[model samples]
Target: MSSDFYTTSILPFAGIIIKICRAYTDSQEDFEDYYQEVCLQIWRSREQFRGDSKWSTWIYRLSLNICLTLIKKKKNNRQHVVSEYQFVEDTEENQAFEDESLNQLYDAIKQLSEIDRAVILLYLEEKPNKDIAEIIGTTPNNIAVRVNRIKERLKKILDGKIN
Candidate 1:
């Protein structure tokens, strides 16, 4: 991608890329890899964007998909390691959640299924159900129900009522 395009189109949405990548990765190395891969994919796939949805919405969907795909590939290659409840330290590159409760909530969110993780992340961003449903490829009503169920599950996870 051209520097102009990267600066104008992609850099502005780096936080969205960071958040999705951070949720899917276990360590700083993996997070950086995922972040770079998402940006690369977004740049490579720029032509595929047809303006059907807002740019941020398209970025969210693409970032989520790239993370999921990378994680799956790692798993299939037997390169994936599952660590229990390890929080990555904040770095200058990604000044991620510093609040203790936010960290705890993110830890809980990490325990969710991949789709649930994506749904909750988008929901937390305050995206409307219609927008979330469009990104997630489901009906708005399904998004509504799923959001409620995911919220309850997150609460249970955070409360230590469920693992």
Candidate 2:
């Protein structure tokens, strides 16, 4: 990638990468490591982007694929611990919840299945269902239904109702 292209296009996505890593990891160390790897992946794949989808959608898809692939590999190796991303706090501005609540929410999101967490992150980013579906390789209607279920599950988590 050209330096300017990377600076303008890829550099802007650092925070999004961090958020995705946080949603998928638990510890600060792992978060930093995964974030770096995701950046490397994005940079390596930048040339392949053809503007087919929104940049954010493409990045989200890429990050989710990386995390899930790692998860599956780990599982196969009998190392199925929750990722270090399981315990992140929400410190982003314009976030609707307080720190404690946001931490709880992140905790809840981390507990979701990989696909479910991707759906919720899309929802949190205010991406429409159609776009989310496109990013996640699912139908729009299916994404909508999944989003509803995710919301209910989130409510259960926040309300201390998960059993």
Candidate 3:
């Protein structure tokens, strides 16, 4: 990929990519892998963009699709490893959110179904229902309903009312 394209196109939307990938990944390694794969796919498919929607909307769809595909692939290749102990390293991304409430909200989001997770993320990003519908391949009304339901569910989860 050309640096010019990367700088102008991808860099501006890196936060969108990061949020979508982070939603699907449990560890920083998987997050990095997802982020890289999404970026690579975006570069590879740049020519396929027809400007049918906004660039950020396209990126949202692409990032979510890539993360979901990787997740399914990992599930299909699951292995059972019995180990006595495991170690995890704290990364900057993990520490990026210093607010405890923000961390709790993210944890609650992680508990949502894949599609619901995507819906909520886009909603939180303050994307309009029409834009979210386009990215999620749903009707605007459907997205509106889903967003309301997701917000209620998220509130319940955060309030310790539901798991």
Q: Best candidate, TM-score-wise? A: 3
| Model 2 lDDT-worst window of ten | 88-97
lDDT values for all models: 0.87, 0.80, 0.90
Best by lDDT: 3
Measured over all alpha carbons after superposition, the RMSD of each candidate to the real structure, in angstroms, is 4.1, 5.5, 2.6
Q: What are the per-residue Cα lDDT tens digits for candidate 2 across 1-163?
A: 4688668876787767777888887666667777777777888998798999889888888888887776677568875569877654644532433566777788889899988998899889888989998988889999988999999888988788333
Clash numbers, per candidate: 0, 7, 0
1-163 per-residue lDDT for model 1 (tens digits): 7999889999999988888898898777899899989999999999999999899999999999999999889988884557887555666444346676777787788999999999999988899999999999999999999999999888887786434
TM-score of each: 0.86, 0.80, 0.90
**Residue 8 C-alpha lDDT in model 2:** 86
lDDT score at residue 100, model 2, on the 0-100 scale: 60
The parts of candidate 1 lying over 4 Å away from their true place are: 79-96, 161-163
Query: Which residue pairs clash in candidate 1?
Result: none
lDDT of 2: 0.80
Q: Write the per-residue lDDT of candidate 3 for residues 1-163, one digit (tens) a residue.
A: 8899899999999999999988888777788899999999999999999999989999999999999999999999989777768655565567436776777787788999999999999998999999999999989999999999998888888877435
Question: Which candidate order results from sorting by TM-score in descending order?
Answer: 3, 1, 2
